[model samples]
Target: MKLAIVVGHNARSQGAVRPDTGETEFAWNSRLAKMIEEEARLFPRIRVKTFFREYCGSYRREIAEVYDQVDAWGADASNELHFNSHSSRTATGTEVLSSGSDASLRYARALQERMGAALGLKDRGVKVRRSGRGSESLMSGRAPAVLIEPFFGSSPEGQAATDEEHEQRALARSILQATQDAFL
Candidate 1:
């Protein structure tokens, strides 16, 4: 199996901001992409590809760019990495989304469960939605795809807490484990 890992946002803009740490979604996702790509090598059955390491214009454009690249790269499955944000800084957790397709949903659910458990965050569950403007064709058919928002970028304390090495490694393992289970 081949996997495409897209780091959300670009160099120009951070998807969201956490008031406390000044951390951006772009930075978080970039780090996670590196870890995930490295960890994925442990599963010999799979090959990994990365996308959107740089910014274009807006997040939607970044998503589009990732999709086109991954699609052309001929991926079996593609996952976009992101951290969530909310009006209430206290709102924090993990969320996985599918394009509402049966195959996509199955993978999304499994990934959500594994990552959520690994994260020990409030399980906000898997959500299924049709692709939209900002979504950048998550459901669009460039191999099976899902968007992973593993934590709230808006929460200062929560973001800071997971910024540790243990948490980052756990997150990468969770992603690789879920992909292994879902694909291999």
Candidate 2:
């Protein structure tokens, strides 16, 4: 299986920031993507590649460009990484967004289960998105794709649970397990 691991957002437009550490989603996931790629080495059958959005002039165009590249590379599946954020600072959980296709749903479910368990967060379940910020990322690719929201960075509890080297490694392992379950 060939997996495209897309780090959400860009350097110029890092998604959400963890208030306590000032870590941006782009920066965190950029590191996580590399970790996931490194973990993939254990799964000899799985080939993983990381992609970053080029902060093009427009968000829509940047997503299109990245998806185009993933398509060109002929990935078997793709996953965009992200974490949630809310003003309330209380929201917490792991959820995955899919395009509602059968294959995408499978991927979402697999990811949701693994990440929720690995992070010890509430399982928000798999959500189907036909339109919205993540819909394009999930649907534009030739292969099945899903966007992962593994915890709310704004939530102190959530951030505390995930912002650690061991937790991050667990998250990477969970992602690899999910990919194997859904595609391998």
Candidate 3:
């Protein structure tokens, strides 16, 4: 199977910030992307392609760039990695946003449930995002696609998790397991 991993934001337009560690969501997700690709590559018959904005152009510049890459890379499924943020520091959990397609919905649920469990986070449930967060996911892939927010970056728990040794590896494993369950 072919998979495309998208790191959520560019350097200039970084996403959420972890309160305790002062870590940017973009930096965390870039690390997760690298770890995910490294681990996923060990699986048999799996081909991986990536859209790391740090290495390429920003998705916000032209959302169509991600859509174009879906066809260009011929991915079987794709995932966009992100960390959510909110005004409330106490708010913490996991969310999976789909394109409202049945396929994507299924994929989103698998990912959301697994990551929420793995991270010991509250399950925020899977929902349709017509625009904004998961829009590029919908426009891009021919197969199932999802945007995963595994934790609240602004929350203390979220910040603490990122500080753990090999937190990126653990999250990457969560992503890979979910992807295998959904697409493999």
lDDT of 1 by residue, 28-86 (tens): 78888888888876888888888874566555555666687788889998888888889
lDDT of 3 by residue, 1-184 (tens): 8878877877787777886777787887887888887887666666777785543555554446765676688888888888889998889888888988877887888898778767888888998988875686566657677888888988888766666757767777777777777777
Error of 2 at 153 (Å): 0.4
Give the per-residue lDDT digits (tens) of candidate 2, residues 1-184. 8999999999999989999899999999999999998898888899999999998798889999999999999999999999999999879899999999999999999999999889999888999999977998987889999999999999988988888899998999999999999987
Using lDDT as the measure, which candidate wins? 2
**Total backbone collisions, model 1:** 2
User: Could you list the CA RMSD of all candidates, in the order they appear?
Assistant: 2.1, 0.7, 2.4
Q: Could you tell me which 10 consecutive residues in candidate 3 have the lowest summed lDDT? A: 54-63
Q: List the residue pairs that clash in candidate 2.
A: none
Q: Give residue 170's lDDT in candidate 3 (0 to 100).
A: 77
True lDDT of residue 117, candidate 3: 68
Better of 1 and 3 by TM-score: 1
- Once superposed on the true structure, which residue ranges of model 2 sit more than 4 Å away at CA? none
List ranges where model 3 is wrong by over 4 Å.
Answer: 54-61
